[model samples]
Target: MMMKQLLLSFSALLVFLHFTTILAQAPAKSPAQAPAAQAPVLPQAQAPALTQAQSPASSGPANVTAILEKAGKFSTLILLLKNTQVGEQINSQISNTYKGLTLFAPTDAAFSNLKSSTLNSLSDKQTLQLIQFHVLPTCISLSQFQAVSNPLHTVAGSSEQFPLNVTASSSNQVSISTGLVNATVTDNLYTDSQLAVYEVDKVLLPLQVFGPKSTAPAPTAPATPKQAPPTTITPVVTSSAMGLIRHAALSFGVAAIAAFSL
Candidate 1:
């Protein structure tokens, strides 16, 4: 009995001693351990990097004047737009009515041949219809103009093709297929004497109005209407010359008759 009691006491003492030793010893940890050990998990958040934004005008010519000014080639056209109330119509009235529209402005040289009366008439609402007829919905650039070898749409909602010609002079020019005859880009010290495809006449209409629901058609053209027609007509007048001829004829007839009678 004493032996069995001694065994139980030894077993209890061994277990207690073992538990005490385990409690006394320190826990093992890596030298690099952090507060993460105390917590079950960590929360994270994302941060974005800085970046540059596109400018308001990068998309295209925002307004009529903007395209005019930026396009160096259209400087004269820009000045003309500045002078005309049509520019205001482009900025305010026409632009408001038809949003996302593009216009092709003819230079002053284009209008020089037109009778002032006719040009004035073209400025009114009804006649302005003809002007609107010349625009395109999409923003087209000089390079885009070259991509097409056929007629295209205008911001004015009309279908007009541009004319590209290779002349004997080894020169190329642009023209719009339209009723009004025009002079293609004139060559001088200007433009490095290189040929360009701008209509001698301005294709006037509203501002950048191209949109999803816009009515204007796409100008698939290389239109350059800057040439005088081959045929020209002039009125003939000989009324003043006829008077002198008549007087001389009458005197000659009378003198002949008198000589014959004698």
Candidate 2:
């Protein structure tokens, strides 16, 4: 009975050792791996919106009076434009038309160079025409003047009575000749796609308004007074007078003889 108990204890000890070795050889469970770190997401930048004032479309049409007013040295021209209401017309045309317009702007000095009574002499109708004479119906650039035909038509009528000629020299100088005055384009005051303003030395004088008058024939000298012819004297002989003289002599002789005899 002692040997059997000892044998049983030894077998139980061997089984316990085998189970411990199997557990040591087996793999152990690792802690769960932390998730990979991710980069922070950022919002994309956006462009700023344009305002009404800053937009190009918001700008209105060009103003002639305002342009001249800003340019200075155009006070007289500005006044005439205002008085004739032509500035408004030009502004309106610029805004409405694609054909465009060209203006020959006479400076204050240009107006001053005229006769003192020049502006005053113009009637309302004539003043309107005079202002219109300076404006071309179509826009013309400085370089384009060279290629244009002579006797260019103006906003004023283009009849023979109102002729405007533009001549450009090889030197790129432009000269404006109306029948009455020849003006040089001294400077370019302003220019754009629709409007071009040039500074002219003289106010363009249209032939219809300022042409020379026909002169009357000078008075003829009075005829000299003619002298009267002198009177002529003539001799006259009478037979009756001779007879009376003879009779008187005979009576005298008879009276003398009779007295001697007595």
Candidate 3:
């Protein structure tokens, strides 16, 4: 009876030991445990967009007509420019052909001050020449005029002597002298890489259009030479007076001596 009881106890203890080993081999999980942390989700990167300023810019200069219109004082000038073929040439020069151009624009008051028939009677060709006289084929700024020579070549292309003369004073005042008219720069209207517009108080009259100012100066120059001849005659007049005085004195002496002797 004692041997059988010992065998039963030993069998029960081995069975319990086997279950404990199996439990240790397997991973343990609890209801309160958290899941493994996943990598943080990140937003996808996008390409950067170009801004307005970064876009390509216009390569050409502004239209000459548009620029003149904005000035608000060149009504007559703008009208004349648009109507004439010379305007085409000037626009071409300002935008493409030439490096730039200098425009001497007369104000409305200046245009109004002209003789009643002055602008009214111009032939088409003459009108073209008149406008050409106002434009310089090359670009020139107010400061640059100080270095340019008098009789600067104009777009007129008439005669070499027909160029405009620029005179800039130390006070920074600039005047343009055409052979017939002298116009001073009243204000600087506009200046840029391709064009320069200067406002003038008087209309620029070309010598080619109006005959050279009266030859009155030519007559005055001769008057100077005539006055020189009068200077030469003074000595002759003085000599004649001296000879008359001597003759009178000699006659008086002879008469007085005769009287005394008698």
Candidate 4:
């Protein structure tokens, strides 16, 4: 009985030792760690700088002649500018001396209205003066004319003799007067930093170039007729034959009575 008991105890001890060794070799179950947080990605703006650098700048003429050529109506004015050499001076002064320029341009029809002799009779110097009279040295807008001082000086250089009078009518029509010539702003052709061109109805003629003429006669009203005078009227009378015979008999009786009494 003793030996059987010993064998049973030894077997039980061996089983216990084997389970301890197996538990020691197994992996431990520690608390699980969360995955490392990823950084948030930011969006980038579009590249306008590269686009702007690649685009080409606009190229164009800044002179008055070039600007006028763009519009078709100023052909007549352009012709005159090229013919007179005033166009060169205008471009020079506007680019160098003056800050800006103002021009009163006439249309093809306006030039056609003039008599051939009017411009033909003028000498080259006179023609230049006439062209200069059309331009104001500085740029003047339509609104500026409304508030201008009387007798506005022109580029023509004769401030006293060739000055212009600017007036705005109640109807909103702006007109310029040079005594001999009166014209209105029919259209606005161009306005910019260096040039302003206004279309005018008539060609400007200065009194300095064209002398003064006689005044026009005033119109008269018709005369009325005179009334007739009043007159006194007389009635006509006829003598009767019986009344004449009675008067003769009475005269004979009176004569006989006078003889008897004698």
List TM-scores for all candidates, in order: 0.33, 0.60, 0.56, 0.56
For model 4, the stretches where C-alpha displacement exceeds 4 angstroms are 1-61, 169-172, 213-262
Clash totals for all models, in order? 36, 0, 0, 0
Question: Could you say which candidate leads in lDDT?
Answer: 2
Tens digits of per-residue lDDT, candidate 1, 1-262, equal 9999999999999999999999889687668745644555666767554221112333322355654555455665565555544555555543344333335456555545455665454444534444544444443334344555444554344343222221212233444444333234332111101111234444432222211235688879997889987786666568878998999999999999999998
lDDT of 3 at 123: 91
Clashing residue pairs, candidate 4? Answer: none
The digit string of per-residue lDDT tens for model 2 on 1-262 reads: 9999999999999999999999999999899999999999988889576211121232787788877887789999999999999999999998788879999999999999999999899899999999999999888888789999878888878746688999887665899899779899987766777888888899999988888877899999999888787677655567777888899999999999999999
Strongest candidate by TM-score: 2
Model 3 lDDT tens row, 1-262 = 8989899988999999999999999997867967899999999999587211121235766466766687787789888897886667766767775668888889888999999999888898778888888888787877777888767888777447476789886665898888778889987766776777788999998877776446544444434333433344334687889999999999999999999999
Tell me how far the alpha carbon of residue 239 in candidate 4 is from the true structure, in angstroms, after superposition: 76
Q: After superposing candidate 3, which stretches have Cα over 4 Å from the reference?
A: 1-59, 158-161, 212-262
lDDT of 1 at 41: 64
